[model samples]
Target: MKAKVVALLCFLNLCWLLIGGGVFSALEWQHESAERVSFEDTRSRLLQNYSCLTEEEVTNFIRAIVTATNAGLTLDNSTASDTSNWDFGNSVFFSSTVISTIGYGHISPSTYGGQAFLVPYALIGIPLCGLMLNGIGENIGNFITKKKEQYKKRWSKKVSDRTAEVLVMLILFLLFLVFLVLIPSAIFLALEGWSYHISIYYSFVTLTTIGFGDYVPGQNSAQRVVYRLAILCWFMIGLSWMAVILNQVSTFLTDIGVKAQTAREERKKKKEGDVGEEGEENKAAEDEENWGSTKSAKQSNVELRNMTPIES
Candidate 1:
């Protein structure tokens, strides 16, 4: 039941990240819009008496052409067409475009409604997403730990120096990284007709979680979520691969053998040291667990104060 609850919460958090990130991401990406335009109401007034063309007349003529074509699109809905500053819909779009790093530069918590919605939304959303990702990442880390042990065991019987095996694996990883990730990304950019630099930037930004929102996939709303999900896959794989690399580095540092007690002790010490550093916080959180049924509340408090911090 607990696992189900946790998983459901995680799934909901992931969905919220997807939706919010999609909208917010779209807004920041607005700055990189491909086209710019200037809309003026004077085009109609100028065109009423003027029919001849001069060197400077070309500017007025072009405005007349645009004015005739747009008719009411610009006049009736001026704010909608206005590109002077970032707009609300654009801001919402900016958030949902990336995983995190939502940039609502144009529409912060300024208005009464904006303040009412944004503050609690952000406070809950950020931690929920963080918790969800970390919970999922723990599973990936466990998988990596197992894979590392398997590799060590496989190499232990025949290989004299584990260094050579690690090097070989690193080489294989590099090859896979290039072929599986980089090449496909290149092909995607080429096929999509996006700039090579922007594509690469998106790929790296997505995997690293830096998500500057300078670039994103699927310009249109219809398939943007799909693009984000594809990018999420990249993040997951990159993280898993990083864990594999970290395990290799750790293996080199710790002697690879049946009896490497010193390495185990060192790792344990590091874990304990980290817990020691968080001693006060941990004790405060778990204070209720320290008590017995018979103890008075005041006495329990005194005992708890005297107790030393320990790790889970």
Candidate 2:
């Protein structure tokens, strides 16, 4: 039964992921289409006002701007310059995002070869990242379990195991919130000169792998290399922290469910046992009535037989 429940939960989770992905994709497409239409309208109005360039020239110029943005390049019109996308520091940052599944997507591969490589790279990298995070989470969970046990032994007092587990999980979660979210938000606020609220929003979004791309670090910063490296480190650690919290929560919920299942089975068995006892008692009472009836009939036959013998 526990296995069945776990399987059902997993199936539901997968379905949810698929549904969410589909909805978000559709919404994104609609948003992009609307933005494109609005942009064209604005461009037409501006062109009408200026009358300095033909429609074809303006269209070509807009296409060039879009192309440059897609390639992570800057336009100067004098010469083509190398994009920061392929730099060592930014490459490392991008790799971390891919493996972690954050995928901010502010920068993306423009070449067919790069795009082809990305699929296989993510396939291999995502699972590797998961394995690493799972290992870390398991180790931390084990350590906490050991400590709880030792504490109980030392105190020699009765403590609810569930309570202890919940407390430990809460502590771990608080620590993650402080270190991963709060501290990072403060640092980003200081370094990026963003408002505190926005910094917090960005940190949460990045750590949660939402990666909305509304705000990205190191885009125009002078310390691009250092900023990218720092962001990568922060996200990697945050991912592991989240993994640990999730593992603990999963384990905690599973344990509760198993206990509830066991209790249910016990109650069912007890009810079945009571029913069997009642059935046995009913059968015994019926046998007793039959025995009494048989004895009475025999006694009557004996009396009749004795009375008839004397006359004969």
Candidate 3:
């Protein structure tokens, strides 16, 4: 039942990313030439309030974006009237085909409004995509942990240290984080005219819950549904993966603390045994010295003070 609900919510979210963007874009341009919307918008808002966009500010914002994304767009490719050679899936292809790197140079959104869309999609998409992958990662993490436990428990007689196993997982986790999340984000951002370091910074930002939302994906609603779903799934996966990594980290730290405590106890016992010939006072002092000077010293001092009378 829970799974079904999650799926339903995801489906709705994808639809919104598409239909919502389309509506917003249409409203955004309503204040412009009361002429018409692009074919994609026309088909989408056929029966809807395509003119709900009254605010001059929103329409200007849309125009500005179109100009920015296609600053050098010529009359043949940038303008809407040059629809003489438009492709069947011009808008759809522009948005979806980005996944395959076949960025068609024609029918580009030559307005600031359109260029603005790409920035958000990628900014949002990268981490979101990471998240989806991370979800797959978490299930994999549990499966691997369970399998390891099965083998180790089945051979319970063996004194294999869970601590050692945990360390191995940590190293592996870090490696995966670098390879999968960091590397790809770097490549994409660099290609998008971003500095390499900035790309890395962006990667860490999303994973750490520092979602500045400055960078997102799918500004173009050409394939709004696909773009939105891909990003949404990414976020889910990335978040889940982070939780698994944290759990492993916590386990690693705890294992270290436990082992350290056990070692300290063994050392204290050995020192006490070696000083058997000395007085109980000396033996106790030796035990105190064997341990750290913090808790043990304060405790020993208290015991010694009690043993000695408070002189008049």
Q: Candidate 2 or 3, higher TM-score?
A: 2
lDDT of 2 at 202: 91
Error of 1 at 14 (Å): 36
**So what's the TM-score on candidate 3?**
0.38
Q: Provide the TM-score for each candidate, comma-separated.
A: 0.41, 0.79, 0.38
Question: TM-score order of candidates, best first?
Answer: 2, 1, 3
Could you list the CA RMSD of all candidates, in the order they appear?
20.8, 4.3, 19.0
RMSD of 1: 20.8
Q: Which stretches of candidate 2 lie over 4 Å from their true place?
A: 1-41, 74-83, 150-159, 309-312
Q: Model-by-model lDDT, in order? A: 0.57, 0.82, 0.60
- Model 3 misplacement above 4 A: 1-138, 147-167, 182-187, 190-197, 273-312
lDDT of 2 at 78: 38
Query: C-alpha displacement of 93 in model 2, angstroms?
Result: 1.4
Q: Is candidate 1 or candidate 3 better by TM-score?
A: 1
Residue-level error in angstroms, candidate 1, position 245: 5.6
